[model samples]
Target: MLGNVADVAQKEAVAALQKALQSGDVEGAGKAWQQVINSISDKVKTDCEMYNTNQKVLAQRGYRMLTTEETEFYQKLVKAEKESNARQAFTDLITTNGGMPETIIEDVYRELTEEHPLLNKITFQNVKYLTRWILNDHTKQSAAWGNINDEIKQQITSGFKEIEVTLYKLSAYAVIPQDMLDLGPTYLDNYIRTILKEALYVALEKAIICGSGKNEPIGLNRDIHEGVDFNSSTGYPEKTPIKVTSFMPKEYGPVVAKLATTESGRLRTFDEVLLICNQIDYLTKIMPATTVMTAAGTYAKDLFPFPTEVVRSNEVKTGQAILCLPEEYFMGIGGNKDGNIEKDDSTKFIEDARVYKIKMHGNGRPWDNTVAIVLDISALDPAYFVVRNDADVLTA
Candidate 1:
């Protein structure tokens, strides 16, 4: 009967401690701590008293109390109770804060970066609504004479073009069953972070391929206007539809040279350019056996000045490659404006689920028209930078 009563008392003591911790009642917690200690002491006292009585009753039979062992055990039990209370107090303090546990956050961040390499490669800027840049026109200069020529030349002024880019809000959310939150901090963190990261990556890939002009940023395919036709016999409906049939290594040099001479010559070296294409085009067309090796025994990969970045997406067509200057790609990310994670628990009563919503505001575009060139691999004149593939191709 004493053991059963003591068990009930210990359970009540633990419940009180938990209630105090949840309510953040420091004074109540202290009282609960004392109660827990007293409960454990009572149990130890009862056990010692029963042992003593048994020893006395069986003294002639050589029964002993073993008081030293009982004392050590009681001390150990008290120490364990104190340690458990301290841990519970710390956990309560952390939960009271809106922040997640450090270990969970760290693990989520690591997994996100590993899964999406583009997140690291792309530059991000923090701003409120929009980011702007001033593009200067190319200056024209007249020849100067040693002698103050008969007439003084008129002063020429250079003009500047302003590009204003507005931010686009990308959001992803998940409805988690309320019971899932009870699965511990690490499980909850992983579930939420994984969903959010997947949404972010999806938004990024779309922006890279088909961002709407002004409303969003123009993507590489949309920015290119020049289209070359590889099969002249089967002419395309439009001169430049941002589509092509095949690719060859021999055409790389001439195309790069044409891009280098755009808008007062923006490109200096081929090494400064990046070729972005779909993985299918890269494998079946770009890196063919004929292009991979040369008679001189040099690998084609080593000889190319520009590196290729293969992105897996349905946005990019099968035979198109975008040549770009990484430095000219501008991306602006707004941190605290519309970019925030909102928790919606109003549906808890109806659906028994918590909806976590996150919105990320960002905008990206090429700094100038000459920053990127789309190559229609199938066409003879594969190199194109201007947004006029339907019109006649301009000679460099």
Candidate 2:
């Protein structure tokens, strides 16, 4: 119970710190961060004092709850990452300690999905290194009543695409200030995780939506059927945006319905769909069009002809929205282990800080061209409260 309480407090402090930093309240941020660090320290101290006799064992293991000399040694290691002799000393220490603990890759994935809504929506596969992604191209192949005829079996055809996930590499860097080492590994983990979350979130979501398929993952905005005889584009084809004059059910429903079938004309089952748009467009266009006054004298939003969840992003362009069945998109990302966090360079950032680089192997793409529709909501009409007295009528 106490551990759970401490976790809640630490989370609250971290949230407060984020709020302060986002609002540019430096003083508030400092205070909130101090609280977060205090919570971390308290937790470490509590764990150390749990058995009282186990403190010595934990200290001998050097698991964050270090003595003053051990603390100084850690500081030395951080500074020495730039120096050959210091790095060698630390490397020898690790070699003697039997290397690093292998952290479960799924835990890292859990942190990302738990924090971001869009990440949780699509398919997230934590695949092994160099794993080949076998995608059955959503092609329709229904079993016939009596498949005894060899000619009938020959007529039925299906296709699958093989993707080499090793071709995709996601690299990101996080800057760690020298002062942060005072908080120990507990807080440092949180800091680096926070940095990685935001950085990876922006990069991954952008690529999944409209990334140029040159060296990156192909996205929803591109035609997924380039190799077919119907599509002439050699490279990933750029999809022509379907125009929309308004967000009325009659105007938008048909366009969205067109995305309900596979490239092979198979129907996809869905209860909820996703609407991804530029942050500005979401506020200026989507919200204004979807929001309506309720009978209880309140406002309800995102009310569409279909069950739709809107995702806002700054990466997408203005006047455009991508609507799709999110389940039709597959994203696979994982790495060897989180145990090998290394210094980006054997140098300092000159700001009493250093940058650490993490390597991730990943790939992503929509299942087919039927997965999403690029929409032009540039001229979407802002709904107004209308008054009427007939049965099932709009009222102010």
Q: Among these predicted structures, which one has the highest TM-score?
A: 2
Q: What's the lDDT for residue 255 in model 1?
A: 59
lDDT of 1 at 224: 32
- In angstroms, give how far residue 388 of model 2 lies from its true place: 5.2
Worst 10 residues of 1 by lDDT: 230-239
Tens-place lDDT per residue, model 1, 100-137, is 32333334335544666544445555565546655553
Evaluated against the true structure, the overall lDDT of model 1 is 0.50
User: How well is each residue in 1-396 modelled by candidate 2, as lDDT tens digits?
Assistant: 655576688778766765564466989966776576556545545544453355565444223343454345455555555466654655554455322232423445676777677777779886657568888876766665664664554355656867765447776555566666555544444455454554466567767777666566778888867463323334476677888877677877788789877887777677878998877798889988888776566778888887889987555668888888888788877554433345643455476666566556677888777888888888888774543345556432
TM-score per candidate: 0.52, 0.69
Q: Candidate 1, clashing residue pairs?
A: 225-387, 225-388, 225-389, 226-389, 230-378
Where model 1 places Cα greater than 4 Å from the true spot, the runs are 1-114, 117-119, 129-162, 184-186, 224-250, 262-272, 289-312, 345-351, 378-396
